[model samples]
Target chain A: MPRRTCGNRAMIWALRLGLMAGVVLLWEWWAPGGLLPTPGQVWHAGIGLAAEGRLWRAVGDSLSIYVAGMASAALVGIPLGLAMGSFRLFGRVVDVFVFALAATPRVAFIPLIIVLLGLGFQAKTFIVFLGAVMPVVLNTYAGVLAADRDLIEMARSTGAGRGRIWRHVVLPGALPFLATGLRLGATIGLINTVVAELYTAVRGLGGLLAIYGNTFRMAEYFVIVAMLATIGVIVTEAMRAVEAHLSRWREER
Target chain B: MTHIRIEGLGHAFGAVTALDGLDLTVRRGEFLVLLGPSGCGKTTLLRMIAGLLEPKAGRVLVDGHRPEPGHDTAMVFQNYRLIPWKTARQNVEFARPGTDVSGYLEMVGLSRFADAFPGALSGGMRQRVALARALAAEAPILLMDEPFASLDAQTRELMQGELRRLIATRPSTVVFVTHGVDEALALADRIVLMSPRPGRIAEEVRPGPGMREYLWQRLREMVLNDPGSDFYGREG
Candidate 1:
């Protein structure tokens, strides 16, 4: 059975690789001229950016901003969500405002944010934070509200005080939802990082995209887009790994 | 000596009364079963005794003071409410911290699966963990609400035997609730039959010859007369 599963895994990998190769070959053949750059040209452009050390610098800059924003979002959002969920009066009072803000487009605030914080790291990070925090707060709140009543009752029956019950039963019960929130927050944060770079200081890969697009350097533009896509996949995969690790007990079910 | 006293115990959910003007006394180291049809408020009585619920009109006292959970009682719920994230050992330890739980786990015969999560265990095994947890607390009272009601017939019988053996070795004031006549006969030293809804004590019997038939007949009469009784649905 183990050998059969291994063979199945190998087959799946082969199919995925074949599909990717086919897509690249098709793109190379179909879009050789005009605005579109061939795969080979994009590859060469990526190598050029790497040789100049611009690729790593842009990646580092973007990642640092993304990390800072997401970290702040989690720090503020989780506790706030917990507080809202735990305290009924507080939740009822604040939820209306929270939902209203979440419903509004975060991009609309970018202009005001740039005006206030200026086109700098702080402004860019704040934009990412705005994009990331709502999902974290909303998901965490829902998670706490949906926590198993029977489990909470059991804890109470064991004479667990309110704080102890929250720590042991409520927190652990909400972990799967918390992990989901973090994953969503990370994705939104990355998107906002690019938006921030473009709208604010025009730095990182977003800056490269603007520069290359304005000059009609299609190969370099494709390189920047590919870099962004790669970063997105890596970040999402990392979040999934963290989620799996956090809920190992739920894995059997 | 009396271990627990319930005086004029009454409760209602909105207009639907569960228990009303009920009074009972439980002797120390006694195995008493509350047997009735579904919706009979047996669980309500058990919860009040566990200190998980407060009686709206009356009071439940354990040894002259109001019952307080953990210090006064440990409970085994029908759902086997073990924390899914904690291992069997950790779940048992949760009942009373700062004490070795190996003995309790062994008592439930789950020493081999101490590291296993409740999710990974069978229904019977999960209940064993719950039993171990309740036992580890070493509380004066053990309140159980149909702890084996969800198990298959064979497993339920096995658990009944296990429970009897365990309680025999370590006696406590036990108040168990169940609708199964066989279950009550197997476990209880004295069984208290409850009336359907607005529950009150109907009869009390000690298990012996012809008692099974007598209880079944009484239950059938209650089910026939009480339109709200879910007994027929449950038995069928």
Candidate 2:
């Protein structure tokens, strides 16, 4: 089984490398004169942008908002979910509001956010926060609700305090659900961050892409899009690895 | 000293009476098995003894105090309801994880599976974790509801031997509920049979210190000559 797994991973990597090589070769056949930049030439443009600090600045600008927005969502969403899920009264009180928020189309609020908060990073952060919180909150609630009743009963029967029961039984049960939510939230977090940035004249990848698109700088535009997609994939894969490790601790071997 | 007593124990679920006017006394270090078919209130009685449920019309006294949950008594559920997320050690520690769970796991012969999670365990192994949790409670009374019924015959035998050894060593007052006549014969110091539907004690029979041969003979007599003498065909 171990050998098969290794072979499969190697095959996938080789396939990816081959596809990347093939795509670059095709791009070389279609350059600026052919209405597309060659892969080698785009690499050169990317390097020139980096040397002039425009590319790095755009990258840095995008990352700050992404990290800040996600951190805010995580900070608030997790605690709120844990509180709602672990306690009946709190969960009941917020149940209607949570469901309503979950159903609302987050993208529709982009115009409203930009209007209210103005053409700034704050507006972009607001949109990302709205988008990122639902999964974390919902998953956390599910985790708490799914906690084993027997385990809680056993604790109660053995003179464990209410606090102890929550700590020992409730928290561990919710960890799996929390990990799942956090993984999903992180992905949507970046996407919403970029989408929110596009709502304003923000000097980030989203804005850059918008400008590049209008000016027909297709090469730079595609490169930025590719970079964003690659970043998303890498972040998601890393989070999945962490989630797997956490989930496996509670898994059947 | 007496460990427990149930006086005029009666309970009804709204309209349908599950248990009616039952009385039982458990002496210290005695192992009493309550035997009955399903719907005979065996589980209810066990729950009452464990303080998981309260009698509507009676009281349960343990060591001269009213039985209360989180004190003086611990129970093993038949379903082996081990928490899926918890390891065997953690489940055994469900009652008191920081205490001497190692000793309790050894009592149920699951010391090796301590770090193993419930999801990775067999039905019998998980039940042993339940047994260990109950044992680790250090409660004076132990109530088990058909804890090993899910296990195969061989594992059941092995667990019975373990229970016997545990009884010999700790000597707590035990109330075990089971539907199987042979199981009651093998385990109990004294056996009380309950009739089905509006359950009540039909007969109290002691099968000679729970010896193998004595149980065999009692099993024979229980089936052949007077099975209905106990119930009188009054059940619905």
Docking class of 1: medium
Question: What are the runs in model 2 whose C-alpha is more than 4 Å off?
Answer: A1-45, B12-16, B208-236
Tens digits of per-residue lDDT, candidate 2, A1-253, equal 2487579879998999899898778767755575776776667777777788887888888888888877888898899999999788999999789999889889877788777998787887777788888899999989999988876766766677888889888898798799888878888888887787777765788888888888888778777887788779887888787776666555554
RMSD of 2: 4.9
The TM-score obtained by model 1 is 0.96
Candidate 2, residue B9: how far the Cα is off, in Å: 3.4
Compose the digit string of candidate 2's lDDT tens values, residues B1-236: 67898899999998888899999888999999987666778989888887777789888999888876656888888787776767888777778756767888887778888888787888778888888888888888888888878788788878888888887888688899876666777788898877655778877888664454543444345445434324212111
The Cα error of candidate 1 at residue B35, in Å, is 0.5
Interface RMSD of 2: 2.3
Model 2 clash pairs are none
lDDT of all the models against the reference? 0.90, 0.79
